[model samples]
Target: MKIQFLNQEHETKFQELRLGMAEYYRNNKEYLSVVYIMAGNEELHRKMNRYFNTKEGMFSSDDMFNEEDFSSGNRILAKLAVHLFNDNETVSPLDIISALDDEWFQLALNAIHFRRYGISSGYDFPEEKLYM
Candidate 1:
């Protein structure tokens, strides 16, 4: 399924916001990912005891990518929607994930417990999809 916007203006505004982000890395081939520290599993969080550039509050679940992310495929997008157009609504970021493709998604999930996370999301991405 695809994102269903409120209307033409809503779609236009969302596209513009995404385009602004996309333009920021037009010539750059490198990619990075958001490392989220979820609200649960404190024991595991402490056992690992390592974090860099992690933002807390909500987590990205494997279930998130499949069909949902609790709130709008992820809360981040919902927040952005609220901030950007005052729309206060969002579809799942799975659309963004789909743009990133499935292999990268699986690779990203696999790396969650790794001590050293890779710079790029995953390999074998096509030119268009390489935007990350």
Candidate 2:
């Protein structure tokens, strides 16, 4: 995603949010496969962060997902898919990732990483179509 930040402060907040998510997944290895799509805008990130960082509430409640729940991955992936796709059709990260054979997966990963580091190159796809 393009992930345009209104200002440098928002971009810094997003970086912080990403770091926190990385740590969470690192600590909870079971959820490592849960795919999270970066937001395309700062307002979305702000809203998502509230749920992700809060101690309790609808999104942050303990009942949201348990490690034992096999469907946890689906739930998380669905949430991300909705945000990224914003289509009436439902899609899952696993579905997309599994469809990516080794070559495509590596290409996508490279593109994502390049964007993450704010790097640009001739091979880079447009931000809007990065995932596709």
Candidate 3:
């Protein structure tokens, strides 16, 4: 399931992530050589390897999505960005619906991301539909 963030910074703040990421990489070039994020939790740390073809960086889960989907507009990327750019922002929500399921992880992840951005779920769990 999709979620509607109070501020919905995924669209606007993504630029922040892109800029911060660029700055981060520029400032610390060693991360390109080694940075570890669990599984798909931080795919970019993984993708950065493939995109650059570093000696030790050989796998990129980005293949899960096509090359064209590199932008942050993708829901997954948006979530990643929200968490990545988090700088002491806490975004709340208007309503949360679950069809009465106990799948709180989705809500937690969403809330956690929002907590980062000061703003913003998942399935009961399956296809998500977000409304503005």
Give the range of the ten consecutive residues with the poorest summed lDDT in model 2.
27-36
TM-score, one value per model:
0.21, 0.27, 0.20
> Best candidate, TM-score-wise?
2
**Cα-based lDDT for every prediction:** 0.29, 0.36, 0.31
The candidates, ranked best first by TM-score, are 2, 1, 3
The C-alpha stretches of model 2 lying farther than 4 A from their native spots are 1-14, 21-39, 54-78, 81-89, 92-132
List clashing residue pairs in candidate 1: none
lDDT of 1 by residue, 20-113 (tens): 3344332222111221112121222232223211222223332233443333223442222222222333434455365433433332332232
Model 3 RMSD vs true structure: 15.1
lDDT for each residue of candidate 2 in 73-127, tens digit (9 for 90 to 100)? 3344334433332232354557548754553344334334433444222223234
Q: Which stretches of model 3 miss by more than 4 angstroms? A: 1-38, 41-67, 70-74, 77-79, 86-132
Pairs of residues clashing in candidate 3: 1-128, 89-117, 89-118, 90-118, 90-119, 91-118, 91-119, 92-119
State the weakest 10-residue window (summed lDDT) of model 1: 30-39
CA shift of 47, model 3, Å:
5.1
Q: What global local distance difference test value does model 2 have?
A: 0.36
CA RMSD of all predictions: 15.6, 11.7, 15.1
How displaced is residue 52 in candidate 2, in Å? 1.6
